[model samples]
Target: MSDRDPQPVERQLPTEEARDLLALVRDIAQREIAPKAAEEEDAGRFPREIFTLLSEAGLLGLPYDSEYGGGDQPYEVYLQVLEELAAARLTVGLGVSVHTLASYALATYGTKQQQVEHLPAMLGGGLLGAYCLSEPSSGSDAASLRTKAVRDAEGSWVIDGTKAWITHGGIADFYTVMARTGEDGPRGITAFLVPGDAPGLSGAAPEKKMGMKGSPTAQVHFDGVRVPDDRRIGEEGQGFSIALAALDSGRLGIAACAIGLAQAALDEAVRYATQRRQFGRAIADFQGLRFMLADMATQIEAGRALYLAAARLRDAGRPFAKQAAMAKLHCTDAAMKVTTDAVQILGGYGYTADFPAERYMREAKVLQIVEGTNQIQRMVIARHLAGPEGR
Candidate 1:
């Protein structure tokens, strides 16, 4: 048999360039992210400067086209980079994922003219973006969102409504907004790219979240927010399809970030268990603790494989929606379990803020909820396997 890479987490990278890229990301994660992650997270500080730094490093636009100032890396490379950043800090990892999601409409569906006008600044030019989908009245039932966008005789559209649970809400430079533009259903909606400084757009105070406090989530209000006809993405009444397509890719991003968080927690647990002693021996030396550690590692590895499998399907341009849902469901659930076990391995110390384990545990909980809840993922998978429920 041919010799294979001996590493357990051995990646089947596509090229030397991808390997170099991974190294660059790891360097940034260690030197810039990890050193301040725990402290800044405790302070609830949003690292805007770090994001700018990442933009400067050309880290934000990987997986998009090089023709439009993006790095043109594939989904596999882009996601592995996300994993590295997440291993350093979940906030940064998830922030990058959200940014990519926010840009998807313009990148994938916007006209050539539209891409030329806005894609560069939004992708890698130090500007941030937010996606507007969830509203106060509709989340799981998102097609029922009531945010309205009405067009005047001059063809200018005016939007009015509140979008809820927006990540990077107050600080985003632009927003990809979906609003109802026609009848009373999914087909009535349309998407628009709205500038952050628009006269009638505003953000409410950030929510008091249980975790990822450094990443703000808030309500954004649009009161007659007007935009030129040129700002619409895709055709009117196609917004729901665009949003669903974006989420299909976005769910995989969350899965990768979840695995990153789980890996970090597992590393912390192993470190603590090996260093801390119990009954005149290291706790890690005991069979029970060893089994727990083994289980955690196995779960993380399995989750990583699941997300990568989904990512590969996406890169190959196959139908990966169902796989994306599976990865998101499996990975986030595994993250919740592994992180909890990690805290258990560290005992009291893990429960304290002094160690990052407790914080990791808290952060892992949100993964199960965002990008669609686990329950929602289950429904998506079931719908794919079986037909939709009969009315």
Candidate 2:
């Protein structure tokens, strides 16, 4: 709403094409996304049309293989693009991340025949996806999921159970689901690619969330939902491993998003303090407020560097699970602090919805709890440092 242009991000891209990709992302974000973000968020309206535009622009699957219609960009470049989108609007950025996560199983584990048959439609054909992992009783303990998929005599699978906190639950064109196929425990789980319109599958009403209402989060039910054997991804009893692998990369996506949210809050605070005067002088002239702004900006930069480092490790085919957890923990915590400080910076106006500070504050809270909680991230780091649990 300010007449000024969106703040520019200084980036170090390896190639000229990557720089151009970032530029196009910023242009679409400012012109198409940021302009409608505040209004649509307030109205709790999901912008399906904007997603269609992103698909056409080849922005939906940047990190996947271009042989299957993906952009074939590295995780390092793809994550920066996520940060730009998150800066403009959390819902759009996070939604894109979830879609990419949902596509992971098929893209990575599917056979050549399966990839050729499905990847094109999923990555570039304007189809949205949802990931179904967490169940009603399973939160941080995801491997203990109770959803069962039984193989029938005709080589068809029948799924029965509930999947909770699914993003894009009702609107997605496909769902990458994890279900129990054998005995209890992580090794017993299996992955499946289920069409959205599968028989006996339905979504409950979206949760009345405190923020990010524009991105629907709901419970999905499968009552004898049937699919052919060919729809399964990876081997039997391999779902839990696939889920964790996806989250390793997905955590970096979340870390980038958190940094982006913090950057937006910092930009707002800096803009407000420099323009608004107190006692015939700008509030930015005060030492206390100036130091506060400095600290906020520093946190954003540090978090950005942390996530990017993790992303680079992933790109290099190195072991980065611990680093990914560290990035997720540090970045989300920083976002919570920075956005809260931005609200404090504005004092009265920040509490009301008149400015974006309050919305950013609300949106940042969920980042701490999503992908994996900060507590879970800490556990992951400690396990890597010491040894596996009970070792």
Candidate 3:
């Protein structure tokens, strides 16, 4: 790590409380998260305790209602918090984003009784969550997921099939799952909140991923996993719509994370460039390197503005899906570009794990692929523009 402390980002928070919240997040991130990030991630160790600490600090539920232990903050504030956490460590930041995504179905669609029963523990009671949507056979084509949830004579549901690429997988306290309940396509699906310890539910080994290895990505299997009817998150056959809505918001979370990762890479590059001298002068003094840094910073700033604009739209209850898709597309692509540029700036050292540029590069690649692939984001944008492609 560079000896120089990274400068704090200047934020335009809406209120004194939000400003204080960001300060607290930076403190926790620096003192607690940043210190061990490189070591733990290198060891492929998941920091479960850090998430518990975040829960204790009320950072886990910022965008939810306070009535059920949430912080009641808007998406703008919540996503900024995500950006700070991600800048400290991608695992923590992305883990928090995935946890929030997992909570969305129930928080937004469940009955008041369901919310009262589950939201408190989920939001601030130290419990973690996973979202179950993608199956081995269905990733980008999620509407074709084969997982089935059959209603028994007792009205309880029996879920069967497997979910692939689950972020928190085996370790989550609960899973917000989508499974087929009616027809063969999107409309046939239903959502359920299954307890982590639900009978017959199990997780396969975590995938050996290229990056974000510390955050487990595993396949979750349901072998007739039973859940009470009350756990159903929305009206029957509404799961696809719920999942899409959650993705629209979730994509913004990813955009924030991508920018955070890019920012970290930029900070690392600047530190290296100024410290490493060539021909009796710092390479950063070279006009070529200076311009590279300038472009990287500009991209990062543009990505940040794009995601924040989408976030504000969400907070205003306006149509923001297209904007969210655009942000996800641009920000992740920018992260990939910026981090790769950082590695280029660092040259040989950047290619090695001795510095974080390589790690940032590796982590940034996944952002382009997660939440929704850049290709999918483009399709979503195009659909919004010219209408969906007809078969």
lDDT computed for candidate 2? 0.94
Task: Write down the lDDT that model 3 would get.
Answer: 0.95
Q: lDDT for every model?
A: 0.91, 0.94, 0.95
Name the candidate, 2 or 3, with the larger lDDT value: 3
Model 3 regions lying over 4 Å from their true place: none
- Residue 183 alpha-carbon offset, candidate 3, angstroms: 0.7
lDDT of 2 by residue, 1-391 (tens): 3344436779979999999999999999989999999899999999999899999999999999999989999999999999999999999999999999999999999999999999998999999999999988999999999999999999999999999999999889999999999989999999999999998999999999889979999999999999898999999999999999999999999999999999999999988888788999988899999999999999999999999999999999999999999999999999999999999999898999999999999999999998889999999999999987887
Clashes of each: 0, 0, 0
TM-score winner between 1 and 3, please give it. Answer: 3
Q: Using lDDT, rank the candidates from best to worst.
A: 3, 2, 1
- Using TM-score, rank the candidates from best to worst: 3, 2, 1
Could you tell me how far off, in angstroms, the CA of residue 284 lies in candidate 1 after the best superposition? Answer: 0.5
1-391 per-residue lDDT for model 1 (tens digits): 1132213246658999999889888899889999999899888899999899999988888989877878989999899889889989999999999999999999999999999889889878999999999999998999999999998889999999999999999789999999999998899999999999999999999999889988999999999999999999999999999999999999999999999999888888877877888799888899999999889889888888889899999999999999999999999999999999988988888889989999999999999999799999999999998879783
Give the Cα-based TM-score of candidate 2 against the true structure. Answer: 0.98
